[model samples]
Target: MFLTNVLNESDCQPIKKSYDQWYTFMDKNVEFWLPDSELHTKNHCARVLLLALLIGHQKGLSHEEKDTLGMAAAFHDSRRLNDGVDKGHGIRAAEYYKDFCREHELPYDVQTYYITSYHDQDDSFGLSEITNSPVVRERGVLLYKIFKDADALDRFRLGPNALNVNMLRTEEAHRLVDFAKDLLQKSNETNS
Candidate 1:
């Protein structure tokens, strides 16, 4: 509701454009590839993308950075097979992203690749743990943080294991937890 209201009322064309493009891309190239998993769906990706853009913008990231984060959010679960403890879904998603970008001839950044590759890694749940990696630090630690929190914000789909506000790394993400959960619940109700 918050995202919809903001996008509906705001004149941020680039964010709106990126948002629309992501949906189109998902519908055209990714949705059909999804399995029967309930947690990793177009709806989940939409929430993650919205959260990423919201938190990334709050961090005052550049337009390019926001775009990369959006892309990462869109593709983060593209390779998910089941909702169970799929430890390496991020890695699989990254590989799928590489192939998707290559086949579509889309321009991509290494930072986005790293963010997508490790978004699901539990180590990424905290800023300190994520920054311990020199590669992510040098490339895009903030990007990774935003992506991770954005992904985490959607954990309401996990029911009892839903994301807690305290677990969100970014302050902005923490603030959005309630709204995200509300949206998630509404989505669930509608789906049910």
Candidate 2:
């Protein structure tokens, strides 16, 4: 899948450079992942990054927050072995995240690692009960929510039943769900 150019110029600018680097990395490392999985490709990562940026921007997060989310988005699934609910891929990806950061001398904090590692485990979609839980509230909650929502928004790629807008965590994410769906539809049509 190719990266979608659906975002506005302002929204795309910050992520463009990172995505450019990610695209090259993905092309080089394509053989490390499941090539045909709708849910775990570099294109999905790009979409997630876009979604994370939109949500973070809507919530008035800092540039650092957005950039961290971008990093989590890009490497969230870098270590996936298969598409069938591989339970520990997040941990593996987190490990790869560390290596990637160190190898490229990129800056990252522990929170970014937590966000990437836990992104797949919680699909709370921002339910107050879950969001209020100690685990989520402890650290990186905002970025975690943004990452989770960004990843969930892409569930449209998994088909209609896969996405539940109400399950989305933030108001902005709920509002953008349909648009995400539209992007998936358009992407499919293009690929078709």
Candidate 3:
């Protein structure tokens, strides 16, 4: 998660500051379905969170908007039963997120809901069937794309060729390609 060298100063400082805070929040406050999993737990989610916030910084999303990314990151992969194409895990995670927020009395965001609900699906399917509502597309599309790209960035953990840059939905996501690799390597090393 050391970005001071890889990321430019403008991007590094804010995200570096935010990273530790969000990671801590996720560790303490968020719940994941596979806490012991190598692929889908906070290790993965935290990296995605960093990637999302880094892209959010470059895209000029507001702090509040970025907060939604944090919420999405905290819960997006929190409900996977298995690592192999768990089709409805996003839906399960979204439902769990709704209940978590209600019981905790925290404000629930619709964009976070949409982002979590459709993240494991293809953009064509997700956008056309579920995430494409005019309100969601208009208000949540960029965030959705950012969150998806962020999650996709972590595909390095699956393997090197696992990520296809062309599939990324944002220019900012493209910029973080190298950072994502290094982040995965470094974070895994640190965890190990």
Candidate 4:
């Protein structure tokens, strides 16, 4: 209700959630593929999840929608084979999410599955794939874009020039540029 009103009325204010707050919430609900890897682990996922929620809020996403982002963030990279360009890692992660849901008897969210399945893929294919899924057809594009931008925001660990501001999908994501950098700095994470 508040998010709906906020979106209808005016721009949403930016929010900064404590990194430690999010980091400590990492429950290892689903074990990461490279748990010990400095590149892809709970820490990286925490940062991406934080960015996704913050971006979702700035975009006035409903609580349910933000929850979807959280789900995506939690399992998107859990099946990675390595730190390098793991071509099908996203799909593997998506399958893992699906299997986990089935095993746990939890409601599966298709949108999160799609977002996880395509997170490592090119934007063109990712966007196209989302359009074909009626489950998320209404807002899948926006959600996918937000997830991508959130993941990209953490690219600061890749190097200084890893993230391009112009490439960001949403204005809110663009606005969080400096915050992303600062968060990455405080986290002391660097991709190898």
Best by lDDT: 3
Task: Show where candidate 1 strays beyond 4 Å.
Answer: 1-6, 9-14, 31-33, 124-139, 189-192
- Candidate 3, position 105, lDDT: 94
By lDDT: ranked, best first: 3, 4, 1, 2
Off by over 4 Å in 4: 1-26, 189-192
Q: Per-residue lDDT of 1-192 in model 3, one digit per residue for the tens?
A: 433343355556777766767777778887777778878878888888889998998999888889889888988888899888999999899998899889999898877888899998989887775444655646488898899999999999999999999999999899889989988887766766
Q: Report the number of backbone clashes for model 4.
A: 0
- Estimate, for each residue in 19-48, the C-alpha lDDT of model 4 and write its tens digit: 233344445367886988877877788779
Better of 2 and 3 by TM-score: 3
Which candidate leads the pack in TM-score? 3
Query: lDDT of all predictions, in order shown?
Result: 0.74, 0.72, 0.83, 0.79
Q: lDDT tens digits, residues 1-192, model 2?
A: 255456335655655665565556555643346667766877777778777877887788877777778777777887898887887787788888888778878775666777777776755533343455555435377778778888899997877789877777788898887778876776566567
Which lDDT value does model 3 have at 117?
Answer: 92
Candidates ranked, most accurate by TM-score first: 3, 4, 1, 2
Tens digits of per-residue lDDT for model 1, 50-135: 77887877788888888888778778888876777777788788888888889889885667777887877775353454466565
Model 1 steric clash pairs = none
Model 1 residue 111 lDDT? 73
